[model samples]
Target: MDPLHAWKDDFRREVEEVLAARARLRTDEKSAPEEGFGGRIADLVIPPAGVYADLREAVAKLKVAQDEAAELRGRFDAKDRALEREREARERLKDSVSRLVLALREERAGRVEAQAEAKKARAEAEAAAAALAEARFDADHAAAKAEDWEREAMARLRGAREAQAQLDRLMLESDAARAEINSLTARLEATACRAAEDGQRAEEAARKRDAAQAAERAASARLAALEDESRAQLARCESLERANQRLAADRAVEAERLVSEALVRAEHEARERAKSAYEDGIEAARQRVEAAERALRESRAAEAEAAQKARQAISALADFRDRTHAAMDRLGERTRAEREQAEADIAAARRGEAQAAARLAAEQARRDAALEEERASLRAQFEDARAQVEEESDAERRVMRERWQEQVQALEALRRGFERGKP
Candidate 1:
């Protein structure tokens, strides 16, 4: 609990003290300038319902959300200050009220003691006949004054004790007791005035009563009536005293109820304030948590770029592999074509060598046949020329033989002649 709010008073203050506290009401914080115009006016013109009701009204009128929030913050701060001032006022008012309640109690005690003293005085005066008249007169004067003061005191008590307490019924009963005492005192005074006025008559009647039995009987009857009236008044006074005691008890119970209610209201308000603060803290924590989640999302925002680069690298690698495979296939095909062309060239060279060898063998056969035919013709011509030469030589020899025979005859003759010529 706040220190100021913890204070409580046992009873109300005296009348003058209550008047002073009432004077301070105009300067209470509920009417402070910081509050809205409508709120301040209401506090001045009427009682408040709740502390923040006017602030809530102000928030409802704002069109912008930000302005509404700002106004609410300002109002909350003002309410805290108002609460502090309320605590101080409550403490001061309780002190003033406590004193007032105590004064009322003191007044009641004085009245009860006064009544008892008057009763004792009456008994004493009746016992001493010498001062009876003087004592009765003095007692009646004191009773008259007490009754008048009682009336005034009860009226003041009503005004001093506001609805802050529940002892109203007790006050009303007190007023009734005061009125009953006033009526009883008026009857006693009137009886005394009548008795003094009839004193001469009473003496004359006494002389007549001695002279007659009927007169003495009437005097006894009048005395009896006066005693009965006195007894009735005494009974009424005792009943008033009992009622006063019962009202005192009821006042005690009412005071206890008032204190307990104040404590309960204070506790409830404190709990509500704490709950509002906790809710504001939870909202701040939630905003921080959302910011953290957003930061985490932003950190990994480039995943698509990295994935695209990886795909490009994979495509390039596949294209390089395809190009390498195509080059190898082309190299293998060119090598096979070169080998086939070399084999075809070798076969053509062998066929060309065989045709050249066949031509050379035919030309050698023709040259050998021509040489055999030329050799046979030259041998036949040489044999024919040799026979002709031999025949011609034999015919020459025949002519020579004839000539030689003749010439032998002639040679003998010529030999003789040559011998003769050589010799």
Candidate 2:
């Protein structure tokens, strides 16, 4: 198939033909001596000396061409070795590039995961913020309720104090009334004893009636004036009794109202009225006692009747005191009950406020802990993502630089191979 091989084949055939012809000549010379015609024919067929010289020159050129070809072949082998090394280097570069690409993909995946985590952190933070806001709102609401409860408790406490003061006043008035009743009872007993002691003296004075007629007229006039005063006092007592009844009815209504509403204004007004009524009743009783004393001193002829009237007055006063004591006792019981109820309500409200405050504090603490933990987690994630990105970037830059250097070296090798290939 090759031109060089064909040429070699042709040269080999020529050398074989020459050698065979020479061998035949030797055989003929040995077989027949002094063959002049055969020798002359052989001499005629053989080439000239110049022709041999030309053949030798051609042979030397062929040897030089073979040496050149051998040199070319050696260079080609060196080129092939260089090419093989380049191919191996390219394969290594390609493998490195594949690995780099895979690393890049993995980095991208990591970035995506980091982004997702960051997003999740943001969502959780937002949720925490919302929960914290809600907790704050609840705390504020609880604070407002506690304030309202405190205000209500204060108002109720004031009311209870007022009621206690009223009760004290009533107790003092009751004590004063009892003292007055005792004095009235002693006066009544003294009056009855005086009336009995004067009974015989009054009969003895009957004979001297004419002699004491002028004195009796004066005493009767004085007695008339005293009677008018006693009548007026009795009317005043009846009016006072009617007023007391009205006040009692009003106090009853006010007490019921106070039990239901617990309004400060209403309770205050009721207390003021009851205090005024008590004061009025006490003043009336003192005036009646003074009027009875005046009547007893000025009316000598009517001393026994006066003592009887005094006894009735004492009886009425005792009855009034009993009624007042009963009313006061009932009012005190109701007031105590109301105060107890208010205290209980206040205590319950305070307990509720305390519970709410505790819950709010716990929620605030929990929210703070969650927020702090979330912040720390986010900070750590941010640092890790930043570090990973920096490492990947550095790796990519190094790979690119190495690849560029490899490409440049391959190009230089190719240029040198081309230069060596030239004739």
Candidate 3:
């Protein structure tokens, strides 16, 4: 059998045994008078019928107790089932809490990753803007160098024109006659030719300066375009940086939300756990209270049973005592009557014996008187005879008198002895 069942059976048996013992005590109390009086007289003399009635009552009480115990056991079994269900519920709740915690942790990690990525993107945008600004500075420096070269070339061309004008005046002022003049003219012509070539070179240089200015202007335009592209790129970078900042802010807010949610969930779970524990404690306390109540009921039942048995025993004893007292009263009355009759009979017999003794005494006295008179007459006669014989013999007369005196003394002793024997 299961251990719980075995324990229950053992407890039930113990209760039965206790009840049986109480019953036996009650039976003994009920039957006590039967031992003093023999069976026949006991039936008429003792009260409460027999031990069977008391035993029946005790058996009935035992049955009631057994039924109550069975009911309590059933209630306890139901409580056990409720406790088991609560335990299962607690386990399920704990598992759910564990999963929520794990999910919260994963969300926190994701939020951190998003934040790191946002920082990295902002750093890249700053670096790109710096490179664009350095490129714009290099373009501006190259345009300034081109402007300086154009100014220097124009100054050199102006100086070369002034020298050529002076050489033309000298050639016009020279004489037109002779070898010297011709030689001077040849020199002037050469000078003029050289000055014209210098002028042409200066014009070519001015053309080149114009081309350099155009190139510088083109470079400035390219630089401006580059600056505009850089500005656009910087703007795009700034937009991306703003986006990263916004994303970081959003992720921070999301992380904070997750943390707050996790905290709220944990608080809710804690409250649930505390509530469950409180309920469990209350259930346990209720079971304890129920058990205590059962125990109190059993104790009260036992006390009531004991009191009932005691009352019954006291009643039986009182009845038995009353019967004994009645019997004793009847016996005392009979003894008194018998003693009175015996006293009366003894008084009558004593009167009769007294009367008979008085008559016998009177007869004995008359007989004694007659015997004394006869004895006196015989003596007197013998004395007279003696007187007559005295004339013949004195010795014979003396002997006869002495014999008569002894005969009288013996008769008196016999009479006294007979009076003593009669009573």
Question: Which candidate leads the pack in TM-score?
Answer: 2
TM-score for every candidate vs. truth? Answer: 0.22, 0.35, 0.30
Report the poorest 10 consecutive residues by lDDT, candidate 3: 169-178
Which runs of model 2 end up more than 4 angstroms from their true locations?
1-44, 49-52, 101-116, 185-423
User: What does candidate 2's lDDT look like per residue over 100-122, in tens digits?
Assistant: 44444444444444455566544
Candidate 1 whole-model C-alpha lDDT, 0 to 1: 0.43
lDDT tens readout by residue for model 1, 60-152: 643344353334334434544554464445445444444444443443443444344344433332333223233334434444543444444
Candidate with top lDDT is 2
lDDT score, candidate 3: 0.49
- RMSD, one per candidate, in order: 95.0, 60.9, 71.0
Predictions in order: lDDT: 0.43, 0.51, 0.49
Ranking by TM-score: 2, 3, 1
Q: 1 or 3, which is superior by lDDT? A: 3
Candidate 3 colliding pairs: none
The 10-residue segment with the lowest total lDDT in model 1? 2-11
